[model samples]
Target chain A: MITSLSVQWRMDEFCELAGLPAECLIEIVEQGILDPGGQAPEEWLFDAAALAIAKRAARLQRDLEIDWPGIALALSLLDELEQLRAENAMLKRRLGRFLQE
Target chain B: MLEPQGSSMDFKDYYAILGVPDSADDKAIKTAYRKLARKYHPDVSREAGAEEKFKEVAEAYEVLGNAEKRAEYDEVRRYGRAGAGFEVPPGWQRSGSFGDYAGHPGRDFSDFFEAIFGSAGRAGEAPGRGREGGRRGQDVEMELPIFLEDTLADESKKILYQVPQYDSAGRRLADIDKTLNVKIPPGVGDRERIRLKGQGAPGIGGAPNGDLYLVIRLVPHPLFDVEGHNLIITVPLAPWEAALGTKVTLPTLKGKVNLTIPANSQTGQRLRIKGRGLVSKLGTTGDLYALLKVVMPSRNDEATQQLWKQLAEQAGFDPRTEWSKRP
Candidate 1:
């Protein structure tokens, strides 16, 4: 869960890079795919992670034929799966020191 | 995305690419696509050339996965074969109209695909009311390997990577090498992605440039293992050192420090060294764990053997009692 002082992108840049409309970005924000800062769309500033998620969501829509809600769910599950796998690997490595087979 | 060069476009057998027979049904084709896509997806796979393979698969599916494009491509396919220089039959007019059915605009298809399906504006193309006169450049992503020791402090690193350049018509020209002295912030985790603004491919026309995303890959340390921000090091101790407490000099990211091994400490015991792991951009530091592992002498002399025998008799300890009780 280590994070840095991320660079932020304005709404126009976010939309341009993510290849999604403002409404779609609003929908994604509403659906919790991204948690960009600011109150309104005009003031909204996205980080690199948000842009990456948006791009992935767009790919799911274009390539996998998934809806926004479905993409959000899939991304969330995939992120959780990745975290669990990392934690599992670390735990296994730690356990291996004591339980040699 | 590498189209065969020369006047004639190479024939791309969509059916062959999907590994389906000519008579394979739509369900079978879709199943094959799904399976291959899952296997080759650049985001999921670590296989070399996976991104290229994914683009190929997506292009194949773009045609074969659709009804109209498949039928139209099928008519063209009858006159061509895979890997051979192909030309559309003279006076061959496609009966079906491809009306933007293949919709992956960001992913550019081959010239042959454009020749068959009719060329459309690339996906990244800005509409008439775009902020810039043209579309921004395509974003680039590349792996950046960082040493575990480097994560302990902020450092400047020189990085060189290639960015693809495209023309105004969205035709790939050549890759341009970009060199930058990137300021790597502290405590960057493995697989963490950082974006550099306007560091990607140059924009076409008067549009702004795209960004470059650097994915962090931590190189395996010789002595330390990374667990998130924390670090682990295996500290080897002599049997006597473990039995009777000893002060050992342990290596930290900064320098060496004294660690006190407790009396009768067992193997696999861990002692945490506070604030010695890694530093984050916010000035927060993680702790390092020293894992104890007691090692015996590799070779024993006669006098050493006699001493060991005397100690064994004096100790009278059986380590395998639990193993004997386990069924």
Candidate 2:
């Protein structure tokens, strides 16, 4: 039920939510692996969704030691898998309806 | 873009002067500069005007070294008159020459060279002037390629990294043998960098040693392709196995596991085995995804071909029916 607009987390909170170590998250930010958004009048902020993505990114870096490009590839594949799973579920639902009829 | 008014100074067209095209990127500019600099450097060249030419080349780099100033100069040159009676636009203050700014010391550009690049030079001056001490030691980067299987298992490995150490004369010495046991956590992929504390050069006067970064690279696997915590394996199934539901042995990280193929399992269908994927740091295991690849026999003798033909005829199913509807 938690949406990006409803949730706001600081650096530590964000790391904890993302299931990433605080030191690892700090390293990622320092190495430009993750952009924490710059300060400005209309500054970009890391909402809950962004924080989740950042955590996923940190996990990929920690687990795979994948560079940015490789990390991008892995994330894309995961996204595709999620999409496929949703589609499969939808198909199964439709098939169940057909069987009932 | 407004044109410059007054001060008809004959500015050197360094890009053209160096025989490099205007649209050349930084690499191209550097290449041209090196070729010209080496040829015209006072110590190297004995030709007349070689020193002047070298200074001019150095001047061009002084302006072009910076991105913002180079952009402004390029704009002005393309639109504004070079040696005509044109005054600089309003609010445009000529602060100081490039040489006065000392943008790049040791190789000083002449005063004429500094005038155009001066404004751009001023912004970067504060940081440069404030910085104390000579140049810091260059950061060293090394790549360590590991197996996907090893990463999944969180294996500790002994890695030999060659790092540059300075002698008494400050000369870069060859890579000294420094072996460290690096513990690779599960799920590491290519290009992940690991930093070693004080593993780099010995800094001067008890200064902090530069860090040694280890970039991770994953060795390619023959059968498996890792996707995050999930392990993707193309399971080759026989035609009979695909047609009829059967329990078949599958290759997994921890040896073979029997997998049930649903009736009429089609190609590209994925079967997931729960908690059989790569192990995470939190002791949670991801699912293993088995992608079905119904492999057909490439070459079959008379008996095998006849068997397949009979089986195909008995099935009475048109696999191409869906494809025919596309048109």
lDDT of 1 at A9: 81
Top lDDT model: 1
All models, DockQ values? 0.30, 0.04
Q: How accurate locally is residue A68 in candidate 2, as Cα lDDT from 0 to 100?
A: 61
For candidate 2 chain B, the 10 contiguous residues with the lowest summed lDDT are B122-131
Error of 2 at B243 (Å): 1.3
Off by over 4 Å in 2: A1-101, B1-138, B167-170
TM-score of each: 0.86, 0.50
Give the per-residue lDDT of model 1 (tens digit) for B145-173: 99977777767788999998877766677
Q: Clash number for every model?
A: 1, 14
True contacts preserved, each candidate? 0.14, 0.00
Lowest-sum lDDT 10-residue window in model 1 chain A: A1-10
What are the runs in model 1 whose C-alpha is more than 4 Å off? Answer: A1-4, A37-43, A89-101, B1-4, B8-10, B23-32, B45-49, B88-102, B118-132, B320-327
> Which candidate's DockQ is highest?
1
DockQ score for model 2, please? 0.04
